[model samples]
Target: MTAPVFLVDAAALAAATVGGVVRLDGDEGQHAATVHRLTAGESITLTDGEGRGVHGEVVEVGKGWLDVRVHELVLEPEPALQLVLVQALAKGGRDEQAVEAAVELGVDTVIAWQADRSISRWRGDKAERGVRKWTNVVTSAMKQSRRLRRPTVEFAGSTTDLATRLRTVDAVLLLHEEAEVGIGAARFPQAGTVGVVVGPEGGISPEEVAALAHVGAQPVRLGPHVLRSSTAGPVGLTVLASRTRWTT
Candidate 1:
């Protein structure tokens, strides 16, 4: 089995060298020490969630912390092509589900979209809480997937705001049911960001689609049948990953 991963402080990990003892504390440490019951001489992996990973063996364990003696340090290279997921807010917890799945599928960044037809609104304190919730989801998914880097989660924004932000991306593919081309055939940038837009349960508005298209986002379909708001982004990401990340 692959070694379980725990997140560590980036600065501390960077300063650590082979044979150095790195401490794991706080929530992650508690889980590692008490929950996982990691004992001395057990193999483990620690990451700063920014591409650096430390492979080590547990040297000591306490009530809520464990120390690992580092043996190897790896810095994963950033993807030549980045995948960004723009997921519209949906009712229930579907949007959160999409974010989790997208992160596991190697999405580089996730932008929450507050679409015009969205039933669940991220208003006032709920807006801040929503972003925090997605951030937590991304962290958990990263560890669950054993990923070296944690994908970023952005605050929820309006359709207009999303369009304005996506204008700077190398390429954007808007997942629309009426789109003529499949995502497989869509053109992706050679070495830049590729944004994938997935609408809410009510779907993307025509005006919103036009707005994204005006910013150079190509309308594309995932498949012949429609998918749920929670399913679309991950499916699109999987297709992109197969053609890009997985191939390499």
Candidate 2:
């Protein structure tokens, strides 16, 4: 069986021995020891959420924490495609679900967009809370998927800001149900970095789509069936990753 993975901060790692012991704290610590019931000598993996992973063995277990000794550290290079998901904030828990799936599907980044048609709004304190919740979700998903790196989540302003961010990447794909072209037929730019934008439930407004297109973002259709806002981002990331040979 694969080793169970845990997310740790940079300070939890040591360079000389390439390993360090950390005192697991909070809910994560309780879950590791009590919920998983891990015992001494059991193997586990630790990640710094920066594309670095270490294989370690449990040395001790306590009511509130566990001790682990790292044996090896490995660093993986970032993916070639560098897929970024510009997901419009959706109602209920749909947007959270999208962020979770994006991390599992190997997205490089997740940008929360306050789209024109979005029912959910992120303003002031709610915005900060939203980011924290999404970050936690992404970290958990990464651990579940045995990923060494956690995707970064950011909040974007207007369609103009989204477009400006897209310009920094090699290419941008705007997924729309109304688009005439299918994603499979769309010619992706030579692999480097790419961004995929998914609209909210109400769909992307014409003005917003035009703004994205003005910045050279291509509109591509997923398939005949229209997917929910939550499902579209992950699906698009998978396709883009495959087409760019990012996963091979």
Candidate 3:
């Protein structure tokens, strides 16, 4: 099995050097030491969740923390093509499901959309809480996938807000059942931000579709069958990643 990756603060990782010992503590440390039961001489990896990684071996284990002797520093280069997911809020935590899976699928950023037909609403403190919850989910998924970088979660907003926010994106492929074009045939820039917009349980409203289309979002179908709101974004991303990141 690949070495389990634990996240460390950027500053802590920056201070780490070859042959030096860096202590892992706090909740992450406790989990590593107790839950994983890492022992001396075992291999592990540490990252700052921003492309910086440290390869090391467990040298000591304490109550709630362990020490690792740094072996090497690794810095992952940023991808030339960035992938973003604009997921419409859905009932029964389906929105959260999309975000978690998209991150694992190599989505670079996530935006929550409050569409006209969305059953779940995020207003006042609920909006803030929702963003925080998404962030936590992204963190967990990043670790589970052993991703070197963490994807960011943006604040939840309305369809209009989403359209405005995506104006700068190079391509926004909005998943629609009635679209004439399939996502596989849709044209996108080779190296820029490409966004996938997934609608709510009720699907994207006509007005919402037009508003996003006015801002350059192309309505595209994933396949002949319509997928649930939670499944479309990740499946769309899989197609894009296959064309972009998965190939030689």
Residues 11-93, candidate 3: write the lDDT tens digits: 88899999998889988899999999999999999999999999999999999999999999989778999999999889998
What is the TM-score (0 to 1) of candidate 3? Answer: 0.97
Q: Indicate which candidate wins on lDDT.
A: 3
Task: Please count the clashing residue pairs in each candidate, in the order shown.
Answer: 0, 0, 0
Q: Can you write out model 1's per-residue Cα lDDT over 84-155, one digit (the tens) per residue?
A: 999998988999999999988999999999999889889889988998999999999999899999998886
RMSD of each: 1.0, 2.0, 1.0
lDDT of 3 at 243: 94
**What stretches of model 1 exceed 4 Å from their correct place?**
none
Q: Note the residue pairs that clash in candidate 3.
A: none
Model 2 lDDT tens row, 84-179: 889999998898898888888888888999898889998889989988988899888988988988898888866777788888877888999889
TM-score of 1: 0.97
Q: Which TM-score value belongs to model 2? A: 0.92
Once fitted onto the true fold, the runs of candidate 2 whose alpha carbons sit more than 4 angstroms away are: 16-27
